[model samples]
Target: MVVGELGSGRAGSTESPPPDSAAAVLAGLDEQQRTAAAAVTGPVCILAGAGTGKTRTITHRIAYGVHTGVYTPEQVLAVTFTARAAGELRGRLSALGVGGVQARTFHAAAMRQLRYFAPRVLGGPMPELVENKLRVVAGAATRNRLTTDRASLRDLASEIEWAKTTLATPEDYPARAKAAARETPFEPAAVAAVYASYEQAKSRDGSLDFEDLLLVTAYALEEHRDVAREVRGQYRHFVVDEYQDVNPLQQRLLDAWLGGRAELCVVGDPNQTIYSFTGADPDHLLGFADRYPDAEVVKLERDYRSTPEVVGLANRIIGMAPRRRGLPGLRLLGQRAGGPEPRFLEHPDEPTEAAAVAAACRALVDGGLPAAEIAVLFRINAQSQVYESALADAGVPYVLKGGERFFERPEVREAVLLLRGAAAGRDDGALVPTVRDVLASVGWVEHRPPPGGAARDRWQSLSALVDLAVDLVAEQPTLDLAGFVTHLAERANAQHAPTVQGVTLASMHAAKGLEWDAVFVVGLVDGVLPIAQSLNRPDAVEEERRLLYVAVTRAREQLTLSWSLSRQPGGRRSRPRSRFLTGIAPESTAARRTPAARAAVVLDGAAGQLFEALRSWRTEAATAASVPAYVVLGDATLQAIAETRPRTLTELAALPGIGARKLAAYGEDVLATVAADT
Candidate 1:
């Protein structure tokens, strides 16, 4: 039985307790949730898996105790990660006929206490709270003579956040970051210097950043007994949701709030702890049993969100993860009936993959599923463009989740403006090179900077535009810079600026705490899924697997996991499916299937001679474009052309890999070259 968000929306009588109100809440709950809700007291830990109704169980537990006269709604402090989750908990509790319970994010709770205690402890009103860290971080970066572009500044801000959340001092940042293998856009020392400057600037301005709210509140509670007693007296019972995401600083803050007592309840699944970069450590959640040896522990395994098939896939993927010591590999026992088996598909390139996914999403929408019940999730934000274009072209409405659309991003808009300006003036030389050159004026480079930085993010946005130019030129060789600008405008207009009440397109991180009827997880290739950054770090690859676990479980009925063999058209097909799928994907037998294995005698034929000539031509074209030889035309396409000996552009266009753009650009040359040889 599901009790929380999955349960009924009816509110109970808030005026007076129905004697059974407390017991009635327990009627539909499963045994585990009943035990958890019945605890009602200190030192309780609920090991809740995905879609297992953790929210429901906890809310019912609070309502059970409140109605039973064991807990006053005001005394129970329920803290979560986000405001939306807290609001949700409040609404759920209200629906269950319980009110006055304080549900809030940790920051919100800290800020409230800080404001109250600041006058007494620090002898003043609270310092002004700054909502954004970018301006301060940019000023610090400027002081340090660091690259202060919006992207670099944003990345630096993230670094500063990680350092502060982990309680790393500015002086300790370089060493601690190194020990932890933290990725930085700039050198460690440089980041440390900027960190010190930012902190100094905040102090001078008498302003507090978000992280400081927790820090200062913790300090006050630790240093002043009066403040601790008053605050702790006001809130006696504490519940922390998503406990696995609690970092050391937050734990310290929580410890302060608890006032050295064990009056606490933590509900979380360690497997879903994916925010380590933000300094979230699962150790606190994993070791809660040991911390309070007498804690009432309950594992909520019955998953109400997914089918048995989806649950099986989720279980298998997470099963392969190298276990963290003391981490319970909570297997979600599916409570729902079996559904269709999840699909695993492969596409030649990113565009085709997006188009295929768009078609699949359209099919699902046509099959009586609401558009909002479907989602297209990918590894990163840069992968959204092709999918957005494909979905828009298919006339499917969609909304970007947790982020703005790729084309609407500021960096992309700036780059497009730069291109538009360039097109307004001088010659619009060759399409791809002209776009590349114009973007380089805005700091675009041939090779991407390190991944996981604001600079890299900005570069990716610009690179998407370049990719669009490449793909556009491939289909329309005569498209000038002005024409390309017009094309981009048309694509943006068709989006309707992210239509509401539409399919969800989001990054995997953004999809957490959300579920859909049909989920299409796209771009599962090597450097993408595991991501290039995770390859070298200790146990980082396993975290990537856990990320996939999160993505896969977001589906209730239909799930499609797909990867691109190559990134773009004219790209090498050397990429393989993510290593995580090694045991799942079928084994390849290229040696047994290809005709090349026939014999060496075939090389003596005229087709063989012509194949070599075409291969030479491919190599020359590739060299001119500075791309792989296969990008011009794969071996199979060259061989097909050699065997057919097409004499006209029309005939050349008839073959695979020879589209309108390719024919327009290479048709005359190819026909002339073939006529000279044939």
Candidate 2:
């Protein structure tokens, strides 16, 4: 068992009264949490286990320090790994009545510093940050006469990012690549040459990419004493969340920010570190105490997020890993009541596994769990394709995490901004003309990309945007360009891509820092979960284990792990269950098997026939229009239409996902199909 000092019940007299003086900020924290929060004076390292209230402890600590006069809110800096996490920290601090605390990701914080000191130190404004580095690198490769395909270019771009994050220069790439045991599609030296050319191009373009923000900021802080002193004077206290994922460049930045001061607190779980591919080192977190000998250490073992059964499975899985020095294993004690035992499911093929998952999700939603409260996490982005089709087939709405948001997409944003610009000078009657001109300006024609790949997806997205504009005009006949632009802006800002009202489909990596009431971990076969590339390397295997651990801990109530025995239907079972399953107690796990061959169940033969007819029509329409079939009509809407057998266009338009534009465009065809069937 791990040990740490507990919070003193007595409130410190020297502490200044916080905004909520009537109630102590430490009132609700557990003993360990309260102690961690109250330790506002010195270096502290918290081994915050999964589901532990790490965020609450740190936010309250900042509030308490402010309340007690130990540190002013302005003097505090809290850095996290993501923009979402930073926003949460800032919001929590505000709720706790502590203002002026700067909570940001390392990139955001460094950029801010760079912006402020660039004029003084670099003799000019900081360069504009490049948004698409791959495009720039591709351009550089072209200039350098290096022949490469799109996929290889993408891989080289990733290599460049890794090298920069690890503080490795062009000359250091070959050795570092060898050390990492990374297999490169191109020669390391060749990639390094492209990287050098990319840098020179950025300099010529007067801009910096994302990685340069941290690198330049670290350099300034080191070479300029006055700048470091100014930053240190402004923020005396530092707190970093998810310290386990901090790369070397970020660590160097943090050290420069602290300037050898001990007024820092870092919280992380070494077992949860899974970003090794991106150059993140958990050793900094594991050896935090050694760096600051006088630091107070705290371990939060009680998990507040997952149920007992879920926590037990997570603990068992992590226990199987080899132990490291200074990194004590956590035996998480679940604070919630027991729920259903985690289900271990096996299917004959990928499609069957996807179907079973979709069926389970539909059942859960039907049983009163909101679709938004559930998620299906897979090992990679590619696994999402079949699951997406399955969910759509089941008429379940879902949002794909890590996919570009509708409003944030380049074509969508361009079109909207054009509309916004045209609206400034155009009247209501001219809206259609303005929209047409905008579309023309954005190069959006009726033509579609030749059937597959990313170009096709982009064309589909653009077509959808045009359809949206058409719908807006049809709905509000009197609305002018300005009114429509205002409406579009409001909706764009209000609804970020992948509306939250649907089942979440995300990669396991993107699912970090999020929790769901029900989680489906799919594609848990040995080669997939451990990922064939990592199988030979022990360290890579360990990271894969951590990835699975992260996936398991994401569930708050229902948890399901699924694997496919074979890649194709009727094929021999080739892939085995992930080796991690061996560590889980058989008694605690429930098993389910899906049949090798199953036929589609048709409840009503007539409705099923009509659904099939509608799908066939939709496929033809989608193919002709060069859009996804779902764009024409969702499976659920088609099913509803078949069941209701809407006789009129009005009735057909009443189905979910059907709007004015769709009604105008497909209403006649849909009515004809239904009438012909009848």
Candidate 3:
């Protein structure tokens, strides 16, 4: 994954794949990458393209400095999306033998410094992490004889957390609580009480949720001169990963930590800025240069990840995004040469689409691609079920991101509650067993039943929870409480967890930092992809386009773009292809014929000769199977395969279009067709 001129196994050694040339050192980089990485003086802004290697560039820039001795790794601060990403970057640095670098998630970094000065700033001990804040809140309500639905409690907690991190105090909660009251469960006063209770609990326990770290640290540094001075002195250079995902809390923390002295290197793909609802603002990244006037800007205009065709499709889609405020322009550099045209697969319904996607994945993997090298991207987390069923049927290995797996399942959570409670010696996990027994025996708790009294509502709600637990316990008597929680955590931590298929089923949002040989973007229709709500706002529409851009670019070599025109299971057909697709011309020959047709043809055939070549090329594989290549393999996959000319199963597997089923079903036939000329 680390790319550079190499000597033997070492990266950045004298033998590194000589930087294509001095002129080509930054060739594979996007305009933003080069600009952000090279700027050593002040703040630099890099609005990256999806899969354009923003993370790679930031890490390497630090490596570049260390290699060039421009700055010690310790002097720089690297911030990323999650704790996992930060660890990955740190490992990458260690792999390159780069030492003294400080790479941590924004929250992690903020907390580290916060804890270092917590005693002085907050006048107390460091905060504890809220590993399961929702569970704690739910348990608290249960114990108080005022049981509430877990969902309601979680929603309330999340809202309170959001407000707090945005620097909203309990006093400020009334207005926000009022505006959100329509959607939230609790009234303003109730919310304020809960917020107070939640903070009290956290402070009493010396624990903090993710957001609290940023909010607390930002306030601490801004208020405490010694802390600010120490931080500014410790790290003079700052490199931020996924800069677009930096919420206001994070931005505040960054500012206070910088103290107007640090040289900033921030990199992110605005197109991948899907966390806006979570308070992240790409505006901070896009406006970096203006924020720091003397900053130099460079553009890494070439991409090394996605094939040109895929890149072209992604670029066109993102071009629809309204320009960011205060930025000159958005430049996407798709450096990879000719490959596949992104296909638009149409399915009859969700189930059918899931089946086809699963089949497609099977074809890719059976052909020789690694399971980890393929992903099925969808709009919503719930949409993954169909794909999961289809994949399970195909006996293909797959991993689900964002869904509660076996361990995180309700049953698993119950098990964990028992185990963790026991481990903490809650009277030999008595509370855990009691909670489980309560849910199992009564189904659910309705301590504060509806106004209809404990009749119809109370019994039903409690019964449901009890039934669930009873069923789980009935199925597995040997499942002790503590053992169950450990199992869930382990299951969640399984990075290479053996999936039913090698494919990854993730929401478009979760697929951000990943890349694969082949990618299938499903459920791309109007109400589904752009989602009906996003159709009105220019910014929302752009965000949708950016989401599409992210999905398309995740494909390293081959990509399949699909949409279902209808949602079945008795529902009337209502959805349409995304209007975003209206801008894209179809590739049918009939659509490509006249003089006036050329513009349409060029637009439809984003890559002219290459597009025609794919459509025209011989395909003995699918021909023998009597199915159109577009069915078994999308046009994008075919184009990439044709252009790349992957000679063997291994190489073909490396292409994104061919999945396990396709490879096993048509590998030889396709290769035979390719071998005819050679």
Return the top candidate by TM-score: 2
Question: Tens-digit lDDT track for model 2 on 23-79?
Answer: 488899998898888888878888898999989999988888888777867777899
Alpha-carbon TM-score of each model against the true structure: 0.73, 0.75, 0.67
* Per-model tally of clashing residue pairs: 1, 4, 47
Residue clash pairs of candidate 1 = 4-56
Off by over 4 Å in 3: 1-36, 67-69, 95-97, 139-147, 173-193, 203-206, 403-501, 569-571, 585-678
- Tell me the deviation in Å of residue 459 in model 3: 41
Model 1, position 471: C-alpha lDDT score: 80
Error of 3 at 509 (Å): 0.6
lDDT by residue for model 1 (248-279), tens: 89999999888778889999998888888889
In Å, residue 184's CA in model 3 sits off its true spot by 4.2
Checking candidate 2 for backbone clashes, the offending pairs are 15-68, 16-67, 16-68, 16-69
- Lowest summed-lDDT stretch of 10 residues in model 3? 1-10
* Shift of residue 112 alpha carbon in model 2, Å: 1.2
What is candidate 1's local distance difference test score?
0.79
Q: By lDDT, is 1 or 2 better?
A: 1
Candidate 3 local lDDT, 165-282, one digit each (tens) = 5566777787864543324566666666677777777777777887887877877778878777777777878887777787777788888877877477777665678866455677
